[model samples]
Target: MTTPRPAAPSPTDALPGGLGRRFSWRGRQIAWTAFGDGPPLVFCHGTPWSSWLWAPYARALSAQFTVHLWDMPGYGASSMLPEHDVDLGVQGEAFAALLAHWGDGWGEAPHVVAHDYGGAVSLRAALLHDARYASLCLVDVVALRPWGSPFFRLVRDHAPVFGRLPPAVHRGALEAYVGTASHRGLRDDELEALVVPWLGDAGQAAFYRQIAQADERYTAELEPLLGDLDVPTRVLWGEQDTWIPADRAGRLSAALGHAEARLIPDAGHLIQLDAPVALATELRGWLAEVGAGRR
Candidate 1:
């Protein structure tokens, strides 16, 4: 059966500081936003979160680089595909398509800053396409083995049950899940932005759909290709990250030929929320090291 297209985003869907755009990919609409004007810097966010996570960082870095932020196929403003269509492999393909789409106007090979599940997507994209990125920053990404939290496992095992949860039940669960990602709890507004997208029927279903589709095979497939990357890479982790431990950053760095894995103290998995300034500073330094131009 053919997949149904999602409703196009209206002006109201645009975040406070970023403009939203949509692109077609494998019969699904992917939502993205671009800000500032310089070398391209793409931000890929993680599970139960969307491009909204990058708004503050985008503003901070946009002064120097054109920041591109997107909701992966099943999250945020993007279309919620069938559960099977939201796996890591498909997400990689979607990123590849998005990169090619971006290339038409932003000609430079873009720099990438990916977080959480986005790490797997970014890694697979680079491996499958040899995508010519200037530099890559992975923050609390799920790139190593034995990943996935206890909550993730429970949801994965009972997706159908959880997907049918009432809106209030889902909201409580979402807030609780998001709370675990940061050492310092999110502000009311921060929590609202993160939770809003997963609130209604479609949103709640998409939440469980993503968890159900989680698989290690995607990252496992890229394991052999990890050391073969030629692009400069930096792995960043929150010292207090509970979802994916900080040690995975060290392993990821070693796997990528001794690239440094810098730890941000007093931060957790949601570094963008917990410490946007520190994350932005680190990103600026990485861009400078790679000689990516800034205005």
Candidate 2:
């Protein structure tokens, strides 16, 4: 029941829109993509997913904004250093480097759309690195204390064991775990996109390594600073989210003082996949409200 090593990804399979590019950061190759023209909007994907998660949405928003997407170090086409820990803190640094890479091309402060663990990474980059963003939209984020699902706890506790599971076992576990993120169940293509990266030897090891490195300490460090956000922020949640619970959105909104929390009914943690049209509409409206579109 050993999992065979996956062949190298074809150029077209490397990234959505055939736009995948690579850069060296912290001795690792970071993969990213940018498209469209106009003000920049960066999309940060959650755990077990990559920039591919935002492909459709990025295309939707490209008409009005230059959409950027990236796979955090351990996910997608990015380098997965088994010896190094790619925790929230490290992700924040990588994000900062990305901002620098975008430089003046990103205009005055890019807008951010982050989901799941991406919310944690974005928050750390904002608070710790002083990364400037015109506005931010957090969806089904892991930004508060008492976070992590029962399964997340299990993985954190036995990451090494899970990492060493037979390939088929790992694949089954991955598919099942990701399925819970959406209430409507994942489509075959969607599931394959999310699961393919975790199928190979390096990908399999990186999957568990990421879980093992999950630490609330980084989020804890930003909790106190949440209330001090100086940019426009909106908290969006999937009403039926079973992973992080929708109520956390209220807490996040309260922390942001002026930000409002909105819920998309009939959607789950993976709102991008469940209700992409609604998510894109909400984001467009928010950007307009914050005058991000004008920039």
* Index of the highest-TM-score prediction: 2
RMSD values for the candidates in order, in angstroms, are: 6.0, 3.2
Q: Tens-digit lDDT track for model 1 on 1-295?
A: 9865344343224454444588988789888878787899998888878887777777777778888888888888788756337989889989988899999997678999999989999988998965678888888998889899999999999999998888888889889998888888887667777777787788788889888889998888988789988888999999999888888988899889957989999999888888877887898888898888575
Clashing pairs for predicted structure model 1, backbone only: none
Looking at model 1, which ten-residue stretch has the lowest summed lDDT? 5-14
Off by over 4 Å in 1: 1-19
Cα lDDT for residue 9, model 2? 47
TM-score of 1: 0.92
C-alpha lDDT values of all predictions: 0.84, 0.85
lDDT tens per residue, model 2, 1-295:
9866445343225344654688788788888888777788999988978877787788777877888888889888789888777999999988988887886665478999999989999988988998999899999998998787789889999998998899999999998998998988987777777788888799899998998899999898989999888888999999999999999999999987888999998899989889888887898899888876633
TM-scores for candidates 1 onward, in order: 0.92, 0.93
> lDDT of model 2 at residue 219?
90
Worst ten in a row by lDDT for model 2: 7-16
